[model samples]
Structures are given as C-alpha cells and as structure tokens.
Target: MKATRQLHDLGQSLWLDNITRTLLDDGTLARYIEEDSITGLTSNPSIFDAAISGGDAYDAGIHAKSLMGMQGEALFTELALEDLRRAADLFQPVFESTGHVDGWVSMEVSPLLAADTAGSIAAARHIHHKGRRDNLFVKIPGTPEGVPAIEEAIFLGIPINVTLLFSCAQYEAVSEAYMRGIERRLQAGLDPRVGSVASLFISRWDVASNKQLPDELHNKLGIAVGQQTYRAYRQMLASARWQKLADAGAMPQRLLWASTGTKDPDASDTLYISAFAAPETINTMPEKTLHAFADHGELHGVMDVDGGDADAVLARISAAGVDIDQLALTLQREGAEAFVKSWHHLLDGIAEKARQLAGKSDGAVLK
Candidate 1:
C-alpha cells in the first residue's frame, strides 16, 4: 500500500499544503485525491504568490476580474475562492464519510491584518461566508492578537484553521480559545460542533536551530517539539473539560502538523511526515513532500502519547542555550512577518499581471 494510504488507515489525515489554479485546471488535484490519499488541503499567501507569479494559469482570470473592477486583494480573493471552492467540492465525499472530522481545505485571511484582532475576525467571517462551502476553513494565525479573533470566529460558527503555532504552549492557548468558543455556544443554546484545527508548525524549528545544535541534535528539534505538543494534545483530549464539551456534542479541535516539508538538505525528505504520524491528527505537507512520502514513506507507528523522550530532548536543547519559549515567540513573529511580505508580493504580482494583460507597462514587475 502507498504510505499515504497507510497513514490514512492509521487515522492520520494526509493533506496537501498547497493549491494552485493550474493544479485544479489540469486535473492534478483530482488525481491526487483519487490516488494519493490526500484528504484535505491548505493554502497561504506564499503558496498563492508563487502560483500567481510562476505561471500564466491565473492570467485570464486576473484579466477578467480586473476588467470587472477587481484588482489587488479583491482580485486575489476571487481567484482563491474559485480554486478553494472546487477543492472543497472534491473533498466533500471524505468530509461526509468522516462525519465532518476530516477533508477540510483552509484559506487564510490577509496577513496584513495579523495583529488587528477585530479586522482578522471580520476577514475570517467574510472569507468563510464568501467561499460558501461547508468544508472551507478560514485560517487565522494563533498569534497573541489572533487568539481573540479565533475564539470569536469559532463562536460565530466559522470553521477555522488556527495557523502559525510553534510550541505546545502556543497550541494550548489556541486550544483553550477553541474550547471557550464552543462553551459559549453551548451556553447560548447553539450547536458546539464548529470544526477547527490548531496547526503546529514543525520543520521551521529545525531550520531555526540547525546551525546551533550539535551533530546529535541537528535535525531533532522539530520532531521533539512535535512530540511534546502531541502529548499535550492527547492529554487535553482526555481531560475532564474536553470530555464535558464532547458530551455536549462539541467536536475536538484537531491538531494539525504544518511546515512538514523538510528544509535541511541533509535530512530525509519524509522526516516530519513519518515521525509525526499520530492518529486523530492532520499532517499538511507541500506537494513535493507529499509525493515523496507517497512514493517511499514509512510509518513505524504513531507518536507516543507520553511523548517518549521529548522532555529529555528538549532539556538537552535548553542546556545547549536555546530558550524554547523565547524561540517560539520569535518564530511566531517572524512567520507572521514573512506572510505579510508574501501578501504584498502577491498583490504586487497581481497588479503587474493585470497591467501586462491590459497592454500597459509602467509598474515595476514583481520579482
């Protein structure tokens, strides 16, 4: 069996952390769903920026939208929704079969509003409503500012994929926000089964710590962090508070593994996917990583619920002078900033494309 099929059978959802108009129009996305066990998908500014700038797939759409008075973000959102709505429709079967527990595609709000809680909340709702798909999740970063937005969005029954989480503590904060939202809904006599996922980034940790670690710890930090966070997640699921909410028909916010693409050239390409294969969790990987895993991946077993040696590994990392908490905060901030840069690049690329399609050539090309 393909490794992706194995992982799916073991209860881990394998999601493609990418989306492009070409992938959809070319039937590649559909092929992946049929053959590769890809149950869900995710998209962000960086992915969209690459998709828009890398090819002419979106040119006709951009030209049409621009002609209709949409440019910049307005145009990008229209393009994105069209692609995501199609992906959502493709995954509708998995979604129904899983009882709404899997097969979700995520669309993030503008990263420019990362710190504006109110604005993030409004954007999330708007995007969710505009997409008009039941399985679409509007991604909101789990940054300090985004927590309230996440809670409010969930209370309003907007399915959310909480992105940009790093450590167990960050995941815990977002999980609490999800629960609070569900609790409020229950109190107000509303259904508490709002679907959500708390995405904890994996590979970036190793990328950030690679140069600082000794040979033994070179590519281990990310997995250790994942193990630690998964432990916390399992505990949370078993806790009395979650049990109470579950009894009230509130679905647990799943823990999604993001940034699973291998960044270190020396490491196994499928490192994150195989190591973090815990049931009831989602692993969203880039297309290259997904294909690599599907071709030759191996899953020895799911992650240890007790976290195995994660505590020991993290202790060694701390002894080596890396403050895990501080690093978590730094990574979150940097990730947000990186997305903001990508957002601008995407908008600039769209405008440049619109100009080119209209036979005007005055704006700077977005390279």
Candidate 2:
C-alpha cells in the first residue's frame, strides 16, 4: 500500500502543507483527497507568494478586487480567503465524516504581525470570521509574542494552526497555551471543543544542524527532534492535566510535523513522511514529499510514544558542539523573517497581477 494510505489507516492524518489555486482548479487537490488520503491542507505566506508570483492563477480575483480599490494586505487576504473557502468546501465531507478531527485547511495571518500579539489575535478573529468556514484554521506563529494570541484565538472559538515551532519545547509551550484557551472556554460555559494543531518544523532542524554534525548525523537532526516532540506530545496526552481537559470535552491539540520536505538532494524524499507517523498526530507534507510517499514510501511502524533513542541521538548532536536550543530560536526567527519576506512578495505579486488583468477579467487561469 502507499505510505500515505498507511499513515491514514494508522490514524495519523496526512495534511498537505500547501495550497494553490492551480491545485484546487486542476483537480490535483481532489485527487489527493480521493487517492492519497490527504485529509487537510495548510498554506503560509511563502506558499501563497510562490503561487501568486509564479503563475497567473489569481488574476481574476486580483482584477476584481483591484476594481474595488483593494490593495496590499487588504487585497491579498481577501483573495486568499476566496481560495480557502473553495478548498474548505472540498474537504467539508471529510470533516463531517471524522467529526471535525480531520479535513481542515489553514490560512495564516499576515506574517507582518508575527511580533504583534494583539494584532495577531484580532487578525485571526477577523480572518476566521471572513472565511466563515468551520474547517478553516488561522495559522499563527508559536513565537513568545504569539502564544497569547493563540490562547485568545482558541478561547474565542477560532481554530488555529500554531506554526513556526522548531523544537520540542516550543511544541509543548503551544500545547499548554492551547489548554489554557480551552480551559477558559470551559470556565465560561462555552463549548470546549476548539480545534487546533501545533506545527513542529522537521527539515529545518536538519538544515540548521547539518554543518555542525558528522556524516552519520547529517540528515538525522530533524527526525530526532520530531521523535522528542512526539514523546512530549504523548506524555501530555496521558497526563492528568490533559485528561482533565479531555474530560471537559476539550479536544487534544494535534502535534503536526511540518517542513517535511527533504533539503538534501541526496536524501530520500520520504525521509520526513515515513519516519514521523504517529497515531493522533499529524504530518503535513509538501506536494513533492506527498507524491513521493504515494509512489514508493515505507513505514516500519508508528513513532514510539516513549521516544526511543531520541535522547541519545540529540545528546550526540549536542556534544558535537551543536546548541540545539539556541539554534531552535534562531531558526524560528529566520522562519518568521522569511515568511514576512514572502508576505511582502505575495502582496507585490497580487498588485502586479491586478495591474495586468485590469480589463481582462473573463477567466480562471488555474482552471
């Protein structure tokens, strides 16, 4: 069986960590849902920036909005919502089938607001309202400043994808923040079943520690970090605190493996997909990795909840002069900055498309 199918059958949801108008219009996303077991999707500024700038897929939306005096973020967010709403419709059945545990599509708030907590909260709330889709998750960075936003967004009944986490500690912090938000809901006599996913970046760890490690340890950093985080995730799930939340009708905030694309050309493309499968967690892959898994991937078994060998491996990497904790901070900062760059590029791309499609609004390029 395809590894993607295997993961789904094992109860680990596989989400495509990408979305483009082309995918939706071309029926590629639909095929993934039917054939590859892709139950959800996620998009960031970088992905949106690439989709808009690298193609003419969004020309009509840009032209229509431009005629309405929208530009910059105001224009881009609306265009993104149009795409997300369509994507959400495609996955709504899966969502209903799974009782809201799967079949989600994520749209991020402006990376420009990563450091602004209140702005992030307000933006998340606004986007949640605009998208008006039950399956939509507002992507928020897991930065220190963004934690309060995550909690507030969750408490206010907004689904969230907690992105930009690069370490086990970061994942746990966001998990705790999620619980706090749910706790608030429970205390206020609200429905405590707010959906959320804490996204842990995988390949970036390997990329960050690659130069500092020996040959054997070159591509191992990402998976090791994932193992450690998965261990923490299991511990949290079975802990007394989490059980209390679960009893209160609060859902567990799934731990998602993100950035699963292999950075090293010589490495196997399925490295991240097959290595990190665990029940109840999620693994969101880029299209290349997802296709590779569907083509020829292997899964020995799901991740060991006890995190076998993760500590030894992480210790070895650390002893090799790789400060993993400090490095996590740096990688997250870089990720946030990169997203900001992509966000600006996305706005610029939309503006350019709006200019080009000023009078030629009779089309759907992605279709």
Candidate 3:
C-alpha cells in the first residue's frame, strides 16, 4: 500500500495545507483525493497571497470581480470562497462518510482581528456564513483575544479551526473555550455538536529553537511539543467534562497538527509527518510535504498517549536556557504578525491585479 493509504489505515487523516485556483481548476486537488488519500484542504493568507501573486490563474476572476467593483479584502474573500466551495464539494463524500469529522476546508478570519475579541467574533461569523458550506471552518487564532471569539463563534454554531496555538496550555485554553460554547448551546436548547479543531503549530518550534539546541536536540522540540499537546488532547477527550458534553451530543474539538512540513533541509522531509502520527488527529501538510509523504512516508507507530519522552525533551530544552512558556508566547505573537503581513500582501496583489485587468479592458474598448 502507498504510505498515504497506510497512514489512513493507521487512523490519521492526511489533509493538504494548500489551495490554489490552478490546483482546483486543473483537477489536481481532486486527483490528490482520489490517488493520495488527501481528504481535505486548508488555506490561509499566505497560501492565497502566493496563489494570487504567483500566477495568472486568478486573473479572470479578479477581472470579473473588478468589473463588478469589488476590490481589496472583499474581492479576496470572494475569490477564496469560490475555491473553497468547490474544494468542499470535492470532499463531500469523505465528509459524509465520516459524519462530518474528516473532510473539512478551512478559511481563516481576517488576521487583522487576531487581537480584537469582538472583531474576531464578528469576522468569524461573517466568513462562516459567507462560505455557506457546512464543511467550511472559519479559522481563528488561539490568541488570548481569539479564545473568547472562538467560544462565541462556537456557541453561534460556527465550525472553527483554531489556529496559531504553540503549546499544550494554549491548546487547552482553546479546548475549554470550545467546551464552554457547546455547554452554552446545550443550555440554550441548541445542538451541542459544533465541530472544531485546535490547531497546534509544529515545525515552528524547531525553527525557533534549532540554533540554540545541541546537535542531539535539533529537530526534536517540535515533536516533543506535539506529544505534550496530544497527551493533553487525549486526556481532555476522556475527562468527565468532555464526557458530559459528548453525552449531550457535542463533538470533541479534534487536535490538528499544523506546520508539519520539515524546515531544515538536512532533516528528513517527512519528519513531522511520521513523528506526529496518531489516531483521531488531523495532520495538515503543505503539498510538497504531502507528496513527499505519499511517496516515501512510513508509519512506524502512532504517538504515545502518555506523551513519551516529551517531558524529557522539553526539560533538556529548558535546561538549555530556552524558556518554553515565553517561547510559546513569542511564537504565537510572531505567527499573528506573519499572518497580518500575508493578509496585506494578499490585498495588494488583488488591487494590482484589478488595476491591470481594468487597464486591459480599457485598451480593448478603445480599439
């Protein structure tokens, strides 16, 4: 069996962490689902920025929207929804078969609202409704401010993909918010089955601490963090608190591994993919990493529920003078900033494309 199929059989869902008009239009996304076992996809400001600025795939759409007087972030959201709605349709089978747990396409709320609790909540609700697809998740950062927004959106029955979480504590914070939202729903006589995922960003831990580590400690921090977070996730799912909600029909907010692509060229390309494999969890990998894993990835074993060696690895990093707690905060902040940067660049690309297309139309009309 191919490694992708093996991973699926072993109980992990492989989702492509990319979406481009070209990928969807050229049937590549569908081929991945049919051939490589990729059941879902995810997109962010960075991915969309690359897709819009890197190719002409979006030119016609941008032109049409431009003629309709749509520009900036509004224009970008429409273009993204166009792709996500199509991608969601492609994954509809997996979604149905899994009872809505497996196939999901995530679209992030505006990164500009990462620190604005009310703003984030409002944006998430708007985006989720705009997509108009039950399988679509509005991604909100697991920032301090975003936690409240997450709770609100969940209570409003918005499926969420909690992004930018870097530690077990962060994951737990968002998980609690999800539970609270579900509990609120139950109290209000609403359905408690609001689907959500707490996205733990891997790979960045290694990138942030790689230079400070001894050679033995290199490339190990991220997996260690993942192990710790997964331990928390499993425990949370089994707790009495979660059991009560489950009895009330609430779904557990799944633990999703994001940023799984290896960063160091010297390391194994599938390092994160293999190390973080576990059942009932989702691994969203960049297309490059996805293809690399589909070709040669191995599932030696799933991650230890007890967080094997996670404490030891983390201790060593702490002894190496890296404050894990402080680092987590820094990474989350940096990630939010990076997203905002990507958001601005995405809008810039859209504006420029709209201008170029408008210029062409004017020229043609003159002729």
Which RMSD values do the candidates have, in order? Answer: 3.1, 3.0, 0.7
- The top-ranked prediction according to TM-score is 3
lDDT (10s digit) by residue, model 3, range 189-294: 9999888998999999999999999999999899999999999999998999999999988888989999999999999999999998899999999999998998
lDDT of 1 by residue, 1-367 (tens): 9999999889889899999988998899999999999999999999999998999999889988988999878889999999999999999999999999998999999998889999999999889889999999999999999999999999999999999999999999999999999999999999999999999999999989978889889878889999999999999999999999999899999999999999988989999998998899999999999889988999878899999899999999989988889999999999999999999989999998898887742343442
How does candidate 1 score on lDDT? 0.93
In candidate 2, what are the lDDT values of residues 1-367, reduced to their tens digit? 7778888999999989888999989899999999999999999998888888887788777877888999998898888899899999999999999889999999999898989999999999899989989999999999999999999999999999999999999998899899999999999999999999999998988887888899999998888888999999999999999999999888889999999999998899888887887899888998988888899999977789999799999999999999999999999999999998888777877777887686455445444
What clash pairs does model 1 have? none
lDDT of each candidate versus the true structure = 0.93, 0.90, 0.93
lDDT of 2 at 244: 93
Q: What's each prediction's TM-score?
A: 0.97, 0.96, 0.99
Tally clashes: model 1. Answer: 0
